[model samples]
Target: MPEPPDPADPHQPIPHSAPWWRHAVIYQVYPRSFADADGDGIGDLPGVTSRLPYLADLGVDAVWLSPFYVSPMADAGYDVADYRDVDPLFGTLADADELIARAHELGIRVLVDLVPNHTSDEHAWFREALAAGPGSRERARYVFRDGSGPDGSEPPNNWKSVFGGLAWTRVQEADGSPGQWYLHLFDDKQPDLDWRNPEVVEEFHDVLRFWLDRGVDGFRVDVAHSLVKAEGLPDWTVRTGMLGDQGEDGTEDAGEPATTDPRTKELGPMWDQEEVHEIYRGWRRVLEEYNPSGDPDQDRILCAEAWLPSQERTMRYVRPDEMHQAFNFQFLEMSWRAEDVREVVDTSLRAADEVGAPTTWVLSNHDVVRHASRLGLPVGSPRPNGIGAGSEQPNPVLGLRRARAATTLMMALPGSAYVYNGEELGLPDHTALPDRLRQDPAFHRTAGVELGRDGCRVPLPWVADEPSYGFGPGPRSWLPQPLLYGPLAADRQEGVSSSTLELYRTLLRLRREHDLGVGGLHWEGGWGPDVLAFRNAREDGRPVTVVANLGEDLLDLPEGLEVLVASGRLEDGRLPQDTTVWLA
Candidate 1:
């Protein structure tokens, strides 16, 4: 639990010792919406390079950029057309190199998104597979199988796509006759790769070297749990196969109820397969090759974006020879309740402790409604994929209060944390986005039953008064920005003490100064059922106590304790409902 050298100070050189990511603050940058240097109505690599200073100033140890690989924009760049090249939509390879270099100069590590489970239909390999016909070696690189049921009209199995429709898509033979079908767990534009193929395995290893050679600190492995399937690709017997009830993120919620142990449930054929561990073990070797000295700063880490049935199942991904971290989705999915929060925190720590890995905490990302808005939804309400003009809206006032409080509590805990861009601005989801402007595949695939993740992917607002709220120099952005963004733009909160942006800056600064990230947690007694109180034991004798009040009633702070920072203003020296405070 020893803390690494203070990354909070950019002037200090990162030593070759202690793995920095163990307790680092990693910021997620959704490239298409982060910033736009060009007036082409889309964000590019140059746009991201121009914003490095902002991230440096935010005090994060690293920035995890979502996919900017060459793509046709189907699935919003998740369908990678080329693993080694930057998309024209983003910029040239030089721009990516410059972005990575500049980020390192500013004392921030850079992580790129890697989607290994599948590739775009336009990828060179997939295209060759299509042209090479049914039994070619190129076709063997992907999951190509003959369909069943007389004349092969029906899919081989009942597997459903996460987006919508059947998981298998039929293709016409070179002679214009009906041919074999291909498997795609997500959109049809993204075809799943057959990891069993030696070529497929070797190809990704080369891709890893390409980026590692280019100076990327690590990779955030997307859909890491689904790379390998059941040995025979059996049909799922559960009520909810692949297209389970939509999660808040517009993806499948395969997790069982929190009250029950998800391990008790039978593992789905399409997810958390046993074979996925072997793939990551090989990846670990690739990462280790770059860090021969085992220097923490030089270590290339892998964080799995796995949505497994339980923390215990998820822990397998971060075993000693596997990934370095896995997203703490249980905490992200939990409602705003003391019991729920405590249970997730306790169980997550216990599970990760067993494997000697750090627990990664995340509240929001590009796929889900921002926590600011989701926290406002009434308890027990159905989680919508996106909030449209006619959808039920969240209370902005209440949402921001809880969001700030939740963030404060999250930062004060042990282990690492991930901050999605725009969360610092206290931005809520664009709930009123018009249907005509929606573009997430989840929206169109489900025939609009699910609003999709477009609300959260809206471009960020940088300047309060400029065109497109300063997201770009142009008058318009790819996705329309709501007028409300103007008030919450970065400029408006720059130095405002009460603003969420300033609050985040202070928290990050103090988190490093107090050595809270690597510190140990000691639960404090006497707190009520609706309150969570714990002491973070710092290296110094001065320990920091974090108290979050989720109850409706105000809580009185104990005498002799100094209030350092608070999520919201205290009412008459008492903690207000849905507020969090740090005291010494």
Candidate 2:
């Protein structure tokens, strides 16, 4: 049978006079920690708008902002109470509009987070559901089921929360008795919406329009695989630390099977179901509706936060009528070995080609430990969810070396890529962050045993000698910046020729000029198993080969080519261990 058609059937496909995001360098900004404009000690929209020139200078085509919608901040705005408004904690709705206008002026598109899977328990819909009793119209918008056993006391299933504990939470009835239970896949404060409810479907379509009308370019759909649940809400066969559990490397495993063939996993009960595609098809129409009014250069796009069992499984997330791109967690979780990296790249490219979607390579993101420190862990050691250290632990020197090289390799790949906010500075996770400051729902719900993602979300250091590392004009930051963060501050590295900032700037400048975004990737064999070599052609067909040395010995590059970029200094004209070079 022939495979699905390219650009799945949208009522009207986004005009691609140039589908600019296809191979775009899109930066993910964790807003609260990005910059603080007000004296509130947290980053806000005003702060982000002020930093627009900074991102534009870095050469990113778009900025994917993490959740900033009105919320109780139960899960750092992921538990959204109002999808149409901005959280005062981040900024005002006006602030968001101004930020959107300013970003477009700078030629940078903006993609806001769209959390469709769940809503804050404080949402009006959920509140009404609580007041109206079970089986009411409001209650119908959510999953409200009667319990099994006598008196309907037990939870409907054996399902557990992704954060921890039971997924069902029993609410009191109007008569002050324990009533029917509701499902929450994440934190208890986040109630899962019943996608089966037409009200919920129509509500999100309106939410998509609210932002698109405000000039936002696209959406980074949160929990894209989770909006729809299995028809029966059947209990899943639980495994040790499975189901929303992070692997040893601090990457989301999503209870997948331990095999390469994603089909074997059959993770159908709660994730990646066939029903989810219809939801995207609907959303695609919403996105396409505004394409006529949008800048052709900035057609609205949808990128999924789907963590599937394999690259092949992930490929389905981007079929024409669905999302434009989906996060490739498999590559992020792969062991830092030359052969392992090469195999993932080869498979990822082949899979993406089969579906006609741009492959997205991401090394670091908000939920995982910083790739800088993760590379320091032993090859087979589980990447710690949070390093949870009271003192210096991971080998920073070694981690940064690998991180720099890894990012260079990632940028030289065939498709779009993501740069976590602090990755450009080669920031390591703050392993020693005090437990009391921890706020991730995972950490609190698990009583700190799960350390959580707080370590990687620390406020970034922007100035060396400034208070709070210039994260804010306030007295203190939301998450404390480490003392070591001083030297790595953006201010300190701004003009230093050898600093990480300069390296990123130079690389971005070169990447855009070479037009590598629209290029093809070809593997160059003959470099030993210790080296991964691949050549990417520019839109003009000029070739640049990226050679990364993952072994312990130094090696000569393809001779006679001029070196365009290197993650580390060249020693005696040979590439050293844990280094990457781009040759023109």
Candidate 1 lDDT over residue span 221-297, tens digit each: 99888878777788753422222244333343544431222445665677777877888899999999999998777
TM-score of 2: 0.93
Which 10 successive residues of model 2 have the least lDDT summed? 7-16
After superposing candidate 2 on the true structure, give the runs of residues whose Cα lies further than 4 Å from its correct spot.
Answer: 1-18, 239-264, 293-296, 390-392
lDDT tens readout by residue for model 2, 16-94: 2347877789999999999998867899889889888999888888999999999999998899999998888898999
Return the lDDT, model 1, position 27.
99
Residue pair clashes in candidate 1: none
TM-score of 1: 0.94
Identify the leading candidate in terms of TM-score: 1
Number of clashing residue pairs, candidate 2: 6
TM-scores for every candidate against the unseen true structure: 0.94, 0.93
